[model samples]
Target: MTAAAVVLAALGAWTDYPELVTLGLAAAATLLLAAAWLVASPKLTVVREVRPRRVFEGGSAQGTLTVTNVGKRDSPPLLVTETVGGHRTTVTVPALTAGHSCTVSYPLPVARRGRYVIPPVELGHSDPLRLLHRDRAAGGELVVHVYPRVHILASITSGGPQDAEGQTTSSAPLGGVAFHSLREYEPGDDWRHIHWGATARTGTVMTRHVVVPDEPRQLVVLDTGSAPYPSPQFFEEAVRVAASFCVAAERSGLPLQLRTTGGAQRESSGAALEFLCTAESSGADRGLAALADLLRDVVSGTQGVALTVVTGRVDTEAAQLLMSLRPRLLSVSLAQLVSPDNTLPARPRGVLTVAARGSEQFASNWNRLVLR
Candidate 1:
C-alpha cells in the first residue's frame, strides 16, 4: 500500500493532477494514525481464576479471565491469549468503558497427568486497519496438578506367610493388650490371663488367648527405563499400575514404599500419586540397579515384606533380575504391559507374573491371583 501511494504521488506530480496528490496525502495520513494507535499501550487490568485446581487424567478444567478498562476513556476491543499445558487459546475482549469489565471463559486441556503452569494472559492492542499490534503480559502464572486415574478393587490380599494358629490377618500386629479369645485355663497359665467372667458363666477356669499381630508391608517398584517400552502408551500404563497399587495398599492400611526412576518415597497415597503424575521414562538403565539396592536394603531390615514390580516390557535379563529377588522377598509379583497376543517366558517358581495389554486387564489378572 505504501508503494502504491508513492507511485500515485509521483504520477500526480508528473501529470499535474491535484486530485491524485490529495488522495495520496490522505492515505499517508491514515497510515500514520494507525501506527500511532497501535504504539499506545492498553490501559486495562486482567484477572484469571481456574476452577478445580486439581483434576484427574482425561478430565476437564475451566479457567475464567476478567479484563477491565481502568482508564477514564473507553478502550478498543483487544485480543486475550492464554497458555495452558503448552497449548494456547485466544479470545476476543469487547471494548470496555471506564470501570467496566468483560469476562471470558475457556476450557483447559487435561489429556495427560502432570503439573501444568498457566502463564499470564497476553493482551493484544492493534489499530482498526489491523496492520500493527502490540502484546503485553498481564497477571501471574497459576499451577494445576493432574493426578493419575485410580481404580478401586474389591480386595487386595497380602501374599505373606500366615500364622500357624489360624488367626486372621490384620493391618497391625497383635499384642497382649488386644484380647482374642478365652479358653479353659491351663495349669501353667498366669492368673492375670484368666477370664473371671467366662469362668463364672461356664463353671470352669478360662484363660485369654492373645494372638500375635502381623503388619504387612509392601514395596512397589516401577521401572521407568526408556529402553524397554515400545511406545509412550505402554509407559503410561506402567505408571497407572504403580499408582493403582499404591492406592490399594493405602486403602488396605498396609505400609507401602514406592520406588521410581525419578525417586523413592514412603509417604501417603497423595505423595505417591504426585510422583506418578510427573514421572517420565529415562534412557538410563539405572532403575534396575536401584530396585536391587532397595530390595536388599528392605529385606535386610524387615522380614516377610511383599514386593511388586511394574514395567512396560520384560526381557531375559530383566526377568532374571526379578527372579533373583524372589528368595529374599516373602512374595514377589511382576506386572508387565504387553500386547494381548504376546507370550512371556516361564516365570520362576516363587515369582508371580501377570501380562496384560493395559491397566484394566492387569488389575483383573492381579485380583484373581491366589497367592499362597
Candidate 2:
C-alpha cells in the first residue's frame, strides 16, 4: 500500500495532473497521520494478576489488569493482549484520567491442567485505519498452576508403616522374603517368588508373602508412556490417579516418592503436584522397566515402603515389572486409570489390579481393595 501510494504521487507529479496530485498528497498525509498516531507513545502503568494463582481444573479463575496513566494528560483507550498457556486473548482498556486508573477483569483458561504463564501484559493502540499499531510491555509475567482433578479416594491404609506422627497403616502380612512365610498364590503376584516345594507338598500354589512393619512411606508411580493409554483422556485419568495418591500421602503426613516415566522424580507433594500439573503423555518406558532402577534407589533409603502404580493399560510385561516390586514393597497396587469411555483392561495374574473408571468408582474400589 505504501509503494502504491508513492507511485501515484510520483506519477501525478510527472504528468502535472492537479487532481491526481491532490489525491496522492491526501493519501500520503493519511499514511503519515497513521504512523504518527502510533509513534506518540503514551505514559501508562499496567499490572496483571491471576486471582488465586493456582486452581484445579474444576474451578474457575480470572485475570485482572490494572492500568494507570502517569502522564500529565489523559490517556487514550488502548488494547491489552495476553497469552496464557498458548491461549491468547485481547481486552480493551478504556481511556483514563492522568491520576485515575481503570481495571479490566477477564476469565482465565482453567478448564485443563497446566502450568500457565501470563506473559508481560502488553498495552497497545492501533490507528483509526488499523494499518499501523504500537505495543509496549506494561507489567511482569505471572504463573498460574492448574492441577489435575483430585477426587476423594478412600485413603488406603499402608499396611507396613506406623508413623510417629500418629498415622497408622495396615500391618497385614504380605509376601516379602522366601521361606520366612508362604501364602496362597494371588493374582498379580510374582511367579518368581512362588514357593515350588510348598506348592508341591500342599498340592496348591503357595508363595512367600512376608511383611515387616516399618515407618510410613509410600511410592507413587505414573506411566507417562502414550502407548499404554487407550486415549488421551485415559492418560489424563492416569495423571489424576497419580495425583490423588500423592496428595493423600501428603495429607496423611506419610513419606512419599513420586516417579513418572517422563523422568520426573519428586519426594514431596508440592513438587509432585507441580509436575503433574503439566505432565504429558510420552512414549518412553512403555514397559515401565526404566522405573526399576528408580524403585531400587528408593528402597535403599527406606524399607517396607508401599507402592502404587498408576497407568492406563498394562500388558504382561508391564504387569510382570509391577509384580517384581512386591517383594521389596510392603504392598503393590496396580491402579488402572480407566476412563468411563475407554475399554476396561482384563485382570492380570500375579498382581493386584484396581480398575478405576471414575473418581467415585476409584474411591470405592480403592478403599475396598487397598484399605481392606
Candidate 3:
C-alpha cells in the first residue's frame, strides 16, 4: 500500500492530477493510523489458580485465570495461552476497560500418573488488523500430582497354618489360641477357660491364660531399577500394583510399610501414595543393592512382617536374596510384571510368586492366593 501510494503521488505530480494526490494522502493517513494503533501496548496483570492440585489417575482437575487491564485506557482483545501436562490451550479474552477484569476457566488433564508442572501463562496483544503483536509471560508455575490406579483386593491372607474353624495359628504361645499359663480366676473370667484340676488341687479357682493374635504387618517394596524392565510400561504397571496393595492394606487396618528403589520408605499410606506419584525408573545400578539393604533392615528391626515385592523382572539372584530373609519374615510374596511372551520362573518352596502381564492380571492372580 505504501509503495502504491508513493507511485500515485509521483504520477499526480507528473500529470498535474489533483485527484491522484488526494487519494495518495488518504492512503498515507490510513497507514500511519494502523502503525500507531499497533505501537500502543496493553498493560495487563494475570492471576491463575488451580483447584485440587493433587488427584488420582483418571480423575479431573480445573483451573481459573483472571486477567485485569490496569492501563489508563480501554484495552484490545488478547489471547491467553496456558500449558498443562505438556499440552497447550489457547483462550481469547474480550476487551476490558481500565480497572476491569475477565476470567477464564478450563479443565486440566489427569490421564496418567506423574507430577505435572503448569508453566506461566503467555498473554498476546495484537492490533485490530493483526499485522503486529507482542507476547509477555505472566503468573507463576503450579505443580499437580497424579497418583497411580488402585484395585481393591478381597482378602489379604498370608497362607500360614490354620485350625479346623479357619482361624490362623499363632507362632507365639502367648498371643494365640494356645494356652500360655494358669492364673487365679478373676470375677470376669469365662467359665469355659476354667482349669478344674488346678482349682481342685490348690483349693482355688484358676483360669487359662490365652493371648489374642495381633493383625499382620505388610511391607510393600517397589522395584524401580531400569535394568530389570525391558520396557517402561512394565515398570509403570509395577508401580500401580504396589499402589494397589498399599491401599488394600490401609483399608484392612493392616500395618503397612512402603519401600521403593528410589530410597523412599514411608509407613503412612498417604505419604507412600505421594511418593509413587512422582517415582521414576532409575537408570543407575544401585537399586538392587539399596533394596537388599532395606530388606536387611526390615529383618533385623521387626518381627512377624509379611513381605511383598513388586518388580518388572526377578532374576535367580534376587529370588535367592528374598528366600534368605524368609526366616525373619512371616511370609514372602513376589509379583513380577513380565512381557506377554515371557515365561515365569518356578515358585520357590517358601515364597509365593505371582506373574502377570499387567496390573489387572496381577490383581486377579493375587486375590487367588490363600493368605492365612
Candidate 4:
C-alpha cells in the first residue's frame, strides 16, 4: 500500500496529474489515521500474575499475562514487550477473536540480588495496510525480590567479649557441661565438684572453676541503613562478616546468635545468608525487631554471649538498649574499623572500632580477630 502511494505521488509529480496527488494523500492519511486509532486503542482487559515471589541469584521464575479482547473494534496482530530490571523480552499476541482470552507466559532468570519491578507491557498494533502502528501500555507491574548468593563459612569470629568478669556467674551445678579443668582440691572443696571415683583412687580433693574458653557468647548485629547508599560491594562485605561470625561461632560449638538491626528472619546456622540477604534496611527499629525475633529462638547454652555490632551508624538509643542486655558489648562500627584519621565512637571500654577495606582487608581483619 505504501509502495502504491509513493508510485502514485511520483507519477503525479512527473505527469502533472492532480487526481493522483489527491488520491495518494487521502490513502496515506487514511492509513495513518487507522494506525493512530489502533495505537490509541484501549486494552479490553489485561491482567498479570507473578510466581515464586522470592528468588535467588541464578534461579528461574515465570509470569503470566492474560489479555482479553473486549473492544467494539477488532484489531490485527500485536507485539508485546515485557521489560524488567533493565532487560526486555518480546511476545506476539495474535489477532484476537471477539470475547476471546489469551495468556502469554515468559521466564525470568534471576541474576542478581535486589528488588525488581516489571515495567508496563507496551503493545504495538498496526493497521491492515501496515502503514501505521498504535502503541499503548497494557498492564500493571509485578515485583520480585532476588537474594544474593551466600558463601558458607564455619568457625568465624569477630572479637573477644569486652568484659570477661561481667560474663562470669555462679549458678546451680550443670552436669556434663564443665568447660574448665580442676586443680587438686586441698580438702575444703565442694563435694559436688569432686569426681568421687577419681578422688577415691587418687585419695585427693579437687575444686573446679568454670573453665572459660576464649569463645564467648558473641552477638554480631548488622546495621543495614541505605541512607548514605552503602556501595554494593561494601554491603556484601558486611554480609560476609555477619556470615563468617555465625559460622565461626557455630564451628567451635560455641553458643552463637546471628543478628541484624535491619530485618527479621534470623537463623542460627542454615538461616545466616537468607536472613542477611532478604532482610531489608528500612529502619533501626525494624531491623532490631527482626534481630530480637531471631534471638528469641537462639539457644546459646552456658556460654557468655557477647554482642558485636556491624553497622553504618550507632544509634545511641539502640546502643543504650543493648547496654541494658550486657554491661558492655564490643561494638565494632565498620566505618571506624580502621583508624588514624577516622573518628571513633566514644571509648566504650569494650567497644572496638574498625573500618572495612576491600575483600582482602575484610578477610585479614576477620582472621586476626578469630585467631586472637
Alpha carbon lDDT of each predicted model: 0.76, 0.76, 0.79, 0.59
The residue pairs found clashing in candidate 1 are 173-213, 173-214, 174-213
Clashing pairs in 3: 157-371, 158-371, 158-372, 159-371, 159-372
63 Cα displacement, candidate 4 (Å): 1.8
Highest lDDT scorer: 3
**What digit string (tens of lDDT, one per residue) describes model 3 on residues 24-125?**
887777777767886776678888998888888878888898999898989998888888877888888999999999999888877899888888988888
TM-score of every prediction relative to native:
0.75, 0.76, 0.71, 0.48
Of the pair 3 and 4, which is ahead by lDDT? 3
- What candidate 4 gets wrong by more than 4 Å, as runs, is 1-15, 36-43, 72-74, 151-218, 222-372
Which parts of model 2 have CA positions greater than 4 angstroms off?
A: 1-4, 128-131, 160-214, 298-302, 338-351, 357-361, 367-372
lDDT of 1 by residue, 117-154 (tens): 88888998788887667888889989988888766543
**Model 2 agreement with the true structure over 293-326: per-residue lDDT tens digits:** 7676766754457788888767767677766667
Write the candidate numbers in order of decreasing lDDT.
3, 1, 2, 4
lDDT of 4 by residue, 1-372 (tens): 678778888889789999998888887778777767665564477887778877755687787888898876664677888787888888888888777778989887567666787877888777666667666887777788765543343233435533333344444233334335556865555667766666677777655655333445556677566432245455555665666566666666565556665444353755665565555555334543344454454333454455656554445655554445443333333322222236544323344444554434655655565457
User: What's the count of clashing pairs in each model shown?
Assistant: 3, 14, 5, 21
Query: Which candidate leads the pack in TM-score?
Result: 2
Q: How many Å off is the CA of 7 in candidate 1?
A: 5.1
